[model samples]
Target: MQIRDLPYADPGRPDVRSGPRFLYWLGRNQLGGQLRSLFWGVVHSGSVALFPLAVGMGVAAVVDRSGARLAAAGGLLLLLGALTALGDTMLHRTAVTNWITAAARVQQLLARKTAELGSALTRRVAAGEVVAVSTGDVEKIGWFVEALSRFVAAAFTTLVVCVALLVYQPALGAVVAAGVPLMALAVLPLLPPATKRADEQREKAGRATELASDTVAGLRVLRGIGGEELFLSRYRSASQEVRRAAVRSARMWALIAAVQVVLPGLLMIAVVWYGALLARDGRIGVGELVTVYGVVTFLLFPLRQFEEIAMAYSFSRPSAQRAAKVLALRRTAVPADDVEAVAGDLKGDLYDPATGLLARSGELTAVVVGDPDAAGRLADRLGGHAAEGAGDSPSVLLGGVALDEVPLDVARTAVLVQDKDPVLLSGTLTELLDVPSSGAVTADAALTAARCDDVLASLAQASPDGSGDPLRTRITERGRSLSGGQRQRLTLARSLVTDPEVLVLDEPTSAVDSHTEARVADGVRALRAGRTTVVFSSSPLLLDRADRVVFLREGTVAAVGAHEDLVRSNPVYRAVVTRQTDEEPDKELVESGKSEPIGESA
Candidate 1:
């Protein structure tokens, strides 16, 4: 693939079995580019290897005082120079292409995986770890793949140079050949220690990154609770640990580098010492001895490629493993094999078999549960979240077809589940509301439906959009700049704008005041008059407005009726919705001039 073609049209499924396997997959994906790099690498190194041969011939011609031999030697030197320049230039270009394409391929895989898993991706892996992998880890993996071809070329050139020397002058050639392998093998024992150090460094760095990400995400909360210093201190400690691990890793690598330097120098000395003896014994000419010395010195350059390749592999292995781990995560299964296609145009009831909760089409249903975790799980099941390790997953059906069986894109288009703690992405207000256009809801209408007029007024204190509208105001990441209630309202507005056939909101107004919560309940009901809406909440304000309220006990639906009837007849429902107990009977309701009618407004 061409470098310009980047981000493959079909990045294709990756082989994420292991670190090495993933790297092999990357190489396989861009086979043509890799081969080009390999060819250029061989040509360049081979040209470099011919340098000493030209030098040897030139010295012999000078010694023999032969004009023709000298001219031929000069011509050979010029040819070697041209080849080296051309090959080296092209090799650098191809190697860079390999690096970019490999990195692009990995980035595409990560993006695809993120889209496939959605929010569940972070639940399975740390958000910071995901960030680290997509950024620095990808570059390291690319570096290893790019360096592999150069390493192969270097090995080939070394072998060819050694054999050429042996054929030209046997005595010195034997000594030079033996020294090269010894120098290359000297550092094998150090590799294990270096690899361990690198792994430690990566682990510490990932921890530091995680700590930093969490701290930043919750900075506003930390400030509110006066715990900012505690988090800062923890981050400082994590940073120091990363520093220590990095230094340890660097020290091991430095030792390896020193070995590379020292051993190559010693090998050069051996070749010169042995070559002098061969020249003295009259077994080889002085010019040939000079050529052998020059050849051995030049060998040191290619030998360094081995050191570089080892270092690259050491750094990249852990990164590849982390990338593979993320790629292996699968979302809830889509049971396509056991089911046939269902008519997408037919709107039907949403049924959760595990909880026996059925929300009919065109109804506003509120689920009230004493346990928030159970409520959350029901909401997740309704949204088709795949729970782990189940041979037959509990399915949520829409239009008689399991939601899990429906294509992910179609399922998502039909049902949108807003989490209890919804995130408001950072952008101008207009950009934040700019979801894909569907149905008939506009941003203004959605904002009104979610009761965000006050939010707009608050934002209008700053400069408004060109139309003098606060809808264009900038929102910080996760809407951290806004109050909890305002962020909740804004998130609700965004969800409304999508206007999906079914909107499943999990405690969407938990942070808002009772009055604002009542308003949101009214707005949602008015806007979603004929669409199925499921709100998981036990708040009296929301429950009172829902057409039907399902009371959940333990894990299953225990009662289903109008909010007033259930509160008056069911003790468990009254205790949950009114926050009543034997000792206290919801003082907020009692003091608000509302007496013991269970569903009375507080």
Candidate 2:
């Protein structure tokens, strides 16, 4: 594939069994690009190697005092120069194209894998590692892929030149051939340490990146708790560690580079000295000595390619391994044979047998879990996402069909779960609200329902001109420029616009005021009047608006009823919803089944 045909429609199924295999797989898929690069590289290296021969011939012609031979030598030099220029130019173009194409393909694969795994990707892989892989690791992998062809061409040209030297003037050629291989192998001993140092540097840098990401994500919270300095200190220490590791890595690579330079210089000196002795003895002509010296100098360029290949492989191997690990992740562990598509319409009750929680069709159900962690897990299960290390297949069902059996797209389409923390990507308000929706709800209506007029006004006021359209206003990354409440409202609005068959929201309004929360609750209930919606929350305002509330304790259904009825009957439910402790005397009496309804008594 050419550069213009980049971003393949299908990046193809990768062989993620191991890092080496993954790298091989990527190369195999781009055979055409590699061949193109290889062809250009051969032309370039061959042309360059022949330059010394042309120069040597010209010198010989001058020494002979033959005009015809001199003219012939000059013409050959001009032709070689043109060929060299053409070959070098094309080789560069092809190499860069290979790099870009490989990087783009890997990026596409990553994006597809990320989309396939959804939130599970983060659960299985650290966010920092993911960031590192997608950013730096990608470039390193591409570098190795692009360097491979050039290295092969250089090695081939070097071998041919050495053999030609052996045949041309065996006396001087023997010394030159013997020394060239020695120069190439001189840096081998340093490669191990260099690779180790590089890996350590990458590890430290990844940690630093993750730390920085976490700190930035929770900057507001850290400031509120007066812990910004603590995090800042920790981050500073991490950054310093990364810096030190980088210095160590750089030092090792510097040593390798030094070896490459010094050894080539030594070989050149040896060749020139030996050639001078041969010339003095009349064993070889002055022009041949010049050729041998010039060839040795040119050989320096190809010799460095050996060190470059070593460095490229050292860096890219681990990067490919990391990428392979991420790509190997599966959203759920259901066997392929068991994956039966949903046979009917994608409308049904969303039920999780693990928790005995069922969200009925065409109804608003609110789940109240005492443990927030359990609530989050349940939400994931309701959306057919098995928890990490969960051995059993996801047992959530839709219309009696196991969710794990249905295709991922089908499952996602049937149930949409919005966790407590929804992220708003950086974009204009209009782009942020634009999503694949059922077309039942308009953006304006969703925004109005989420009570985002104030958010729009603030965005507009924050604009530099202070008079542009609100929808056109650009949001900062993660909506950091907006208040927590505003971000939450905007996210909720985005979710509402989707209008999925089954919408699961976890604490959708925890960041908002009571007044705004109540309005959001009412708006949600009205908008989802005939659609199945499951909300996991404990707020009285939200629970009161629910048609039915399912109370979960220790991951099992403890009570199920209307919010008012549960509040009056179940002491534990009342304690959870009211944010009170069951140890209270009145609550204890109700728990003991010896008192009136807590609501009536209060």
Candidate 3:
């Protein structure tokens, strides 16, 4: 099947849809697997379920006719048994292929979604939830999809056996045929509750996964505050909640299992009771009674399968809906399609109507504010992370194009934003700089700009299992293997490689030493000459090299001048940048009971 044909989130679809419709969609896509298994299912089920009944009929014929009939019936049973074995083998092979295809299609959708959303994806979805969906959820979904066809094939085989029984004795045939439906329908009432319970369990499980992920991600930080026990206690509570939810779900499923067994047995008993009465009245012969009983036994297989189909679907529906929600998140903004069709030097005039701030093109703009939250949100909008109220909210612009109007892919490739706390993905020194883009620049150039020329020398191409070198090496997840400064520098270096038209760096040199920070500032100015660059730092070294600095008073632009000009002309801006707020009296702080820090921390 083609990748595009697989179901993604179709948010527009109505909710009144049914399980049969879902089955049909899956079945339509399962042609290859079905075709491979169909003949086998037909042969194997027909032989295994139908042959015994057919033999019972033949045995009745032989008993009436003696030794002659017995010889012919024996030969026929052997032939049917061999056919059943062949069909059994083929059916298994085909069903597995079907399961695999369905799984592959879901994986493709997930991969495409991850690419479409980029950095914004993790912001919207938990890493552990995504991981669980890829491994466990996909398998569950594939199973439900594949089960549809086999379920139908089993039901159809049962129908054929019932018809054969009817031809032999109409009274028993009608009873057996009618009873199968009643047996299957008994479980229908239990399905909705089962699915509801399953959905609850799934949610609890996802929450538990998120809790563990959060704790592990902040493990070092948690230890620093001695809050590890607090978090561990919270996690323990969450795990207990999940376990309780799981038990409730298991109970419902158990009831379903109990119904599956009891209902079919009741149907078998009814057939036996009625068939005996007919034989006693001389309306049906003994051999016909045997065939009737055999046919009812054969019908049990499909009846059981019908119950399984109900159970499979009840669990899969909610997962599919959850997956759809993730796929349905609209992009933060819809940028104009006409982004110059090419890359060029972007004059760094940034305007955000939402915050009433503007940084003119071709200058280093330092946005100083008392509110860091406002700054970060504004940064996300500029970095192409989809904003929540972006539709009605005002936007930041670059090169006279509203940031929201720029397509995500183009905006991401063109404007790079390095957050203050950037993460370095694990890999060789080369790969770390190549994140969000391929390794397009020479390793030496990126390292020079990020000031990681020395850090690279300390690492080697190594593997856990040994023996591997290809100019590529895998790094540990989240750069846990590297030091904090090392990770930050590597991230800055990689962001530099793209050499975007606009570089909005939010404290890029925060983790490095003063000397390394100075070098990074010099390297940044040199590497970004003629390009629009904005570095969000209060460091004097970064400020000294700026072509211009726009001082922000609150959210609005209060004054615009060179770094020295702003320092001399604007009192509040100077006091804020130079950490002069501490000079204020302790009586003023105690009287107000609240105070604002001049240089805000993100």
| The best candidate in terms of lDDT | 2
lDDT of 3 by residue, 169-217 (tens): 7888888778777777888788888888888888888888888988998
Candidate 2 lDDT for residue 154? 93
**C-alpha local distance difference test of each model:** 0.83, 0.86, 0.70
Candidate 1 per-residue C-alpha lDDT over 1-602 given as tens digits, one digit per residue, 9 for 90 to 100: 77777668998888889998998888887788778888888888888787777888889999999889989989998998898899889889988888888898889999988877665577678888998999999999999988988888899889988998889988878888888998899999999999999998888888889999999999999999999999999999999998999899999999999999999888888888877887888888878987888888888888899999999998888899999999987654445653234435426788877777778799999988787866766676677554232234467777776776555566677888888987888888999899864758989899998899888987877645456568667888988888999999999999999988888999999999989899999999999999999999989899999988887766767778888898766666788888877334455555566544333221
Error of 1 at 373 (Å): 8.2
lDDT of residue 465 for candidate 2: 63
Where is model 3 poorest over a 10-residue stretch in terms of lDDT?
A: 10-19
88 in model 1: Cα distance from truth in Å?
2.5
Candidate 1 segments whose C-alpha is farther than 4 A from its true place: 332-347, 351-358, 369-381, 385-406, 420-499, 507-523, 526-530, 551-560, 569-602
List where candidate 2 sits over 4 angstroms from the true fold. Answer: 332-348, 371-377, 386-395, 420-499, 508-531, 545-547, 554-556, 581-602
TM-score of each prediction: 0.82, 0.84, 0.81
Please tell me which model should have the higher lDDT, number 1 or number 3: 1
Per-residue lDDT of 423-462 in model 2, one digit per residue for the tens?
9999999999899999999999998888998998888886
After superposition, the stretches of candidate 3 with alpha carbons farther than 4 Å from their true spots are 1-27, 125-132, 332-348, 369-378, 387-395, 420-490, 550-602
Instruction: Flag the better candidate by TM-score, 2 or 3.
Output: 2
